[model samples]
Target: AQSVTQPDIHITVSEGASLELRCNYSYGATPYLFWYVQSPGQGLQLLLKYFSGDTLVQGIKGFEAEFKRSQSSFNLRKPSVHWSDAAEYFCAVGVGRSQGNLIFGKGTKLSVKP
Candidate 1:
């Protein structure tokens, strides 16, 4: 079975400061890692994913993540955040099952300061 753990349940970052969210996973084989962001009363938008190739992957809104195989960690980072970026961010692992639904972490709520 595959599973994910997000150390931080929530986070708050200033409007222009950098941000980082930690994620760790456990799976039998290499799993597809993804990061998604959800705003108030909105659906989740894919931030990024790691299927193969380079360990580091980039996503929308100036976000990026580095996949560390040894540590089984995929952490999301952004150089600078905006007030509009305030929302709940979820880290998920996609399993290669018939259903494509993702197993998501608890989610980290980002509060950008003005």
Candidate 2:
């Protein structure tokens, strides 16, 4: 079985501060990892992914994630945060690779301060 874990249910940061969302995954072998963001009342949008080759992958909206095989972790980081950046972030893993099914974490809700 494959699963994703987002330890933090919610996080708050100043509008100009830095941000980091933690994620952990479990799978039998190399898994397709991803990060997505969803604004309130909106659908999920792809943030970034790690399939092969480079462990560090860049994504849209000034986001980047590093896949650490040794730790089974894929943490998302942002050098600076903005008010519009507030949203629900999810870390997911592609299961049933051929079927294209996904197992997603509970998600982390981000709040930005003025």
Candidate 3:
């Protein structure tokens, strides 16, 4: 079965510290991948996506991810994390060609310290 796994359920990072959130996927073929952020009481917001293109994809809010086919990983990284970045981050994969067919990871909650 295809799935997305976010190893960390919760992470705490000091303000201005570098951050990296891991995401791994299992699928038969190269699948469409995405990273989404959801704030408290807010809906999910797209941070970035990877389909068929360069290995490195840039995203909104100074975020970026690299698609590693060999490793089956698409990890999200940021040079510095802000308190505003504290939220829940989800890693997802399109199960089918259709955009609606997606399987999302449990999600990782990020907490920023002062």
Clashes of each: 0, 0, 0
lDDT, candidate 2, 22-75, per-residue tens? 999999888899999999999999999999999999999999999999999999
TM-score, one value per model: 0.94, 0.97, 0.97
Q: For model 3, where is the 10-residue window of minimal lDDT?
A: 94-103
Indicate whether candidate 1 or candidate 2 has the larger lDDT.
Answer: 2
lDDT of 3 by residue, 1-114 (tens): 999999999999999999999999999987999999999999999999999989999999999999999999999999999989999999999987865798999999999999
Full-model lDDT for every candidate:
0.91, 0.95, 0.96
Candidate 1 yields a Cα-based lDDT of 0.91
Candidate 2 or 3, higher lDDT? 3
lDDT of model 1 at position 33? 94
Model 2 regions lying over 4 Å from their true place: none
- If ranked by lDDT, best first, what sequence of candidates would result? 3, 2, 1
Report lDDT (Cα) of residue 112, candidate 2. Answer: 98
Candidate 3 colliding pairs: none
> Which residue ranges in model 1 land beyond 4 Å of their true spot?
97-99
